[model samples]
Target chain A: MLDHLGEKLIARVSIGDFVVRFDLITIIMSWIVIAILVGLAFYLRRGLRQNIEEKPNRIQAVLDALIDVLQEQLLSNFISTSLARRMFPFISTLFLFVLVSNWLSVIPYLQSPTQNLNVTASLALLVFFTSHLLALRRKGGRRFLKGFIEPYPFMLPINLVSELAKPVSHGFRLFGNIFGGTLLITVVSAMIPLVLPVGLTIFFGLFIGLIQAFVFAVLAVAYINLAVES
Target chain B: MDLTLELGKVIRSINWTFIFTLLNFALLVYLMKRILFKPALAYIDRRREQIASRMEAARKSEATATALVAQREEELKATHEQARRTIDDATARAERIVSAATGDAKKEAERILAAARRRIAQERTQMEADLRRAYAEIAVLGAARVLDREIRIEDHQRLLDTLIDEIDEQALMVKR
Candidate 1:
């Protein structure tokens, strides 16, 4: 119903007061996006060839171009092509998941999972852990910890705050944009409930969805580069 | 207004969804690495190597063809030179045979001419000798007939003997 608009309308499993709670709607939306990406991956996998044709099918060409751009982006940021290849899967998965989740709002009854703080926080946390862990692995714990004291030891707290701020900003950025857009569309639809709101929803939700996905992947790669640099 | 406030609360909430989303993203990355990303990069690398090997094979074949052409050309040149030498040797042999045959013919002709001249000289000398003997016999017969008139047999015989001896002397002088 229109009454339930802008609300994540699904079941919840709550434990003790202020303890752990599970948002079933977020879980379902995430699963749907994951299923789509998996299906697409399988299709692309079936079509892959060692000797790519000069004139490939439409699907092949598009997928190849997507792979090329992603690799180029990674290679540009990272020091080595091997490192780029190693991080490609995680970055691509993050991009596709966010993009799909943000755009799912085009359906009248569906809410984008990225509109939820929990979902965005989880994604940002993954990037956070991955960057630090990889840095620690490559530079060793001593060197990685020592990076905070560089230029001057007085900058240590500032560097630590900045490092901690990465995930918070990364998560909030996507969540705010998507959630704000959804709220605006919900208000418009509540007023008009007609053609104008539909167009506005598509424009803000779909187009901005694509931009947010790209920005998130770019930030993730930049963070990885910062971490990996010795 | 109350519904909008509740929706806003739901949007802001952080719960077990975080854990689920992280698990989902991690699973997706794993599956994609196995099914798509790794294989695609491998395919591209394989394509590069294949193109390089093909170019190398083409270059090798081209070099082999060039070498074969050069070898054939050398063989052809040698064959032409050998043929020319054979023709020159045959020509020299023909010339020598012709010259030797001409010399043998000339010597045979000279020997035949010399044998004919000797035979002609011998026949002429024999004919002259025969004619001189016939003439002497006729002269002796005529002298004997003239002295046959009146004389006894012994005187007539002595005169005949003296005429014959004079004729023999004159013949000897002519022969000398």
Candidate 2:
């Protein structure tokens, strides 16, 4: 079943004795998506006006709707409107990037960056760093460290383990979902090679793609909120 | 036993790569934060501003509508007051006209009564004059009869004098 997905798309780019088979296409595609996202952001920022008489263009309206949804979600869930306003951008951006990357797997002949251990692990690490960074920023270093020893001194090891488990879980969850979905689609396509596999491919591929993206974004926002509050 | 040892060796060998991948992901996230996060935040802020602006515009429009309603009410009230004043003025004018007409009617009636009284007085005076003349004629005829002959100038004059005195006294009594 796993063999049906074929070998990983690896590029043999050698640097002297070290031979690294990096997935160049995946990285390039990710860069492209990131560039487009950045461009959209700049465009929206540029179009914003202090005076409301000028109607928002289509792109600006879409961006506004996205932000509004994010703001409402954050405000309702974990934070005050003011704090949500401050923190929503980071959370929303992380979600959008992860969502786009996860969906990338569904595209024929393209690899999901998240399925790559390096990509998922790196994103997880960033989330890990951000959680700590927010904690330190909000509570100060001493108080942030003190969170590990809550309830009793004996619980410190458990707290530490839990803290360490966050990034590992975060990365693994996304990687496993995309990898599993892709593997399933590949197997079905190989076995049936007809109308039946097409339905399964689309269902598992798109549904899992969307769900994984949502999970990643939601978890990220929740983690950030937790860190900031605790 | 050999397979387990090989697996352990493979795990140990892969650990460095795992570490390297972790580092690479960290670097990528860092770069993404710089390149993407800041702009995305700006976009979100822009979006927020837009929503707030729309809310403000709606509020302002509502305020304007309220002010317009109030102004309209004030104008309507003023118009109502002006209408009331006009009605009152019209009523006062009607009252004045009615009173003036009544006064004119009364004055006209009095003038007519006065004129009628003057006409009656004139007719009474004429009647009295006629009665005097008739009485004089009778007195002349009776005197003639008493004499049993033609009345001469001197007797006639005496009779005339006595008759005139009697007639004057009767007329004065009738008048009294």
Candidate 3:
């Protein structure tokens, strides 16, 4: 409805007290992103599966370049090549998934899933959990637990709060930018309803989307780097 | 049913969609790992390996080529040195032969000169002896004609002696 432009299109499935609401639009949009990524992946695979050419065609070269750039970013952050390579699949997926989700807004009347707090929150939480897991694996149970206490015993509460705040800030950062963009675009379109909305949409959808997605991935990698380092 | 994108009482905006989103992301991560990241990165890595090996092969071949060139150059230099030595040896041998031949020719010429002088001296002595014999015969004939008489053995001997002595003295004077 025009009255609640920012509202999620919800579909509810209830089982007594446990109510599971699926944001239908968001799920659909997420699936669309997923399919696109899958198709692109296969296109990449097809190129690779062929007798790997010394010279790649245009599309494959772009894909290869993107992957290589991500690798260079990962290598720069992580101290070890092995760790970077090991986390390549997950980190690259995080970047591509976020990038695609954010960019989906360029289509008319299509909402970016990243605009939803739920989606960004989930992604941030996922990153938080993954970083902690890597910390535990790298530092072991003893060292990982010791990180909470830190330089002094009294600092544990502050450290704990700060640690908890990481995901909160991380999630809200993306959510704020995208949701704010969506709201601004919606409000501006309603008032002006001129050619200006198109520019704003492209600016928000392409530029901001790319930047925010990159920031998110970099933050995620940074978090992982912090956890994995000695 | 009262959902607003407001900061006020934002608790309601957090809903079961979080669960769905979580599941979707997890599924996507798995699917993407299988379909996208793993294969693409694996291929990229493989291609990197191929490039590295090819470059290594090229580098090895270049090293081998360089070594071969150095070896050939050394061989060529050695051949040149050997040729120079051979030329030097041949020049030495030729000089030795020429010098020996020259010495032999000089000795032979000197020997021929000495033999010719000895032969000339012997011929001169023989010619003088022949002249002396002819002179004695001429004297005997002259004495017979001058005497114009038959003479005994003792007187003829005496006359020949006198003529021979006179001829000897005259021949000595002519030689001085």
Candidate 4:
């Protein structure tokens, strides 16, 4: 456990025994990740459709491959193409944001935003809300709520608890891995101070980062699929 | 339970970070949808449509070319047939013309042969008449020698004239 690495408080306000502490590190890191993603987006937009030739240029090919892979995955998993199209941007951005945040910790003093419970919880909450919203839109409010009581009336409470636990598990899984991994790497590097720990950090930081990001997106998609099932 | 408290001590509790992270992620999603995903996906779709239409156009042109080739071949066949017919007709007409001329030439040769035969027959009759007259003159000269006088010669000539007239009459009857 890294008590010292706890998010630094940027400001605090207290009124009549109620207190609010703003975690500056997590907030700034989240903004940095957002900035990085948005900058990449702009760069991609600038270079988009630059070549109309039959053979795609380097940038076009990379973007095409990325979209193709994501779309193909969605097509395979989703019930319909329209549903996949509707959910594509959210899932893709989720992956890119988490992936970048997780990897950004490789630089000193730049902790992964996803390592913080606050950020992961927000993302999970987004998935949770979006899933229910879309289900409601598709099935109407009455039927959407009735889904938790299906299969057997006796299973209602268990289904409700399961639905509630989804976001918690989704958030904690990513948060725990990134936070534990970064802490372990930092401790090992401080103790050993050698090439082995450095290489290990790179491996855990980048490779695990990628895996965790993919997991988060896939889980989101699965949750959405589960929520919208008729 | 003690471990839980220690974990809580290490893990940073939620704060304004949640709100800021949410806002940042939302902004990022909107920006990505606008700048990156939409345009990129649109370009890909447009490229796909373009390729499909180009393929369709190419197929149509190819079909048209094939049809034109078939039509040209049909026209060529007709022209060849027409030319062959014209040649056949011209050959038949030439043959007819040659045969007609040959028939007329044969008739003209027969006419010339008949006219030559008739002229030869008339010439022979004239030569025969002349020979008969010469023979009568010779007979009158022999009679004068026998009588040893000019007085009986005139009478002999008159008899010869009557005999020659009778012979000419007989030759005319034979000819008829």
* Candidate closest to the true structure, highest DockQ: 1
Q: Give the CA lDDT, 0 to 100, for residue A31 in model 4.
A: 84
By lDDT, who's the top model here?
3
For model 1, the stretches where C-alpha displacement exceeds 4 angstroms are A1-10, A14-20, A49-59, B1-8, B59-176
- Give the docking tier of candidate 2: incorrect
| Clashes (N, CA, C under 3 Å) per candidate | 0, 1, 0, 0
lDDT by residue for model 3 (A1-230), tens: 35766555676665666666667778889889888888888777676656675578776777778787888765457767888888888888888888999999989867788988888999999999999998898899999999888888899999989888989999999989998898888899999999989999999999999999989988988888876673
Pairs in steric clash, model 3: none
Error of 4 at A211 (Å): 0.9
Question: For every model shown, what is its TM-score relative to the native structure?
Answer: 0.66, 0.63, 0.76, 0.69
Q: RMSD per prediction, one decimal?
A: 13.1, 9.0, 9.1, 10.6
Alpha carbon deviation, residue A83, candidate 2 (Å)? 4.2
Candidate 1 on B14-101: residue-level lDDT in tens?
6667888888888988987888888877877776787788889999999999999999999999999999999999998988888888
Per-residue lDDT tens digits for candidate 3, residues B1-176, read 33323221223567766888888888878887888778787787888899999999999999999999999999999999999999999999999999999889988988898888888778768767866786777676757654865776877777778767867776775454
Model 1 chain A lowest lDDT segment of ten = A9-18
Winning candidate number (TM-score): 3
True contacts kept of each: 0.62, 0.09, 0.47, 0.56
Q: How would you encode candidate 2's per-residue C-alpha lDDT over A1-230 as one tens digit per residue?
A: 54424344444545666655445555666665566566666666654543445667775577567766766654356555665655555566666677777766666776676666656666777778887897898899899888888878899999988888989999888878777777677777777888977677667667777777777777777777787786
By TM-score, how accurate is candidate 1? 0.66
Q: Which 10 successive residues of model 2 chain A have the least lDDT summed?
A: A2-11
Which structure is stronger by TM-score: 1 or 3?
3
Q: Give the TM-score of chain A in candidate 2.
A: 0.85
lDDT of 1 at B95: 85
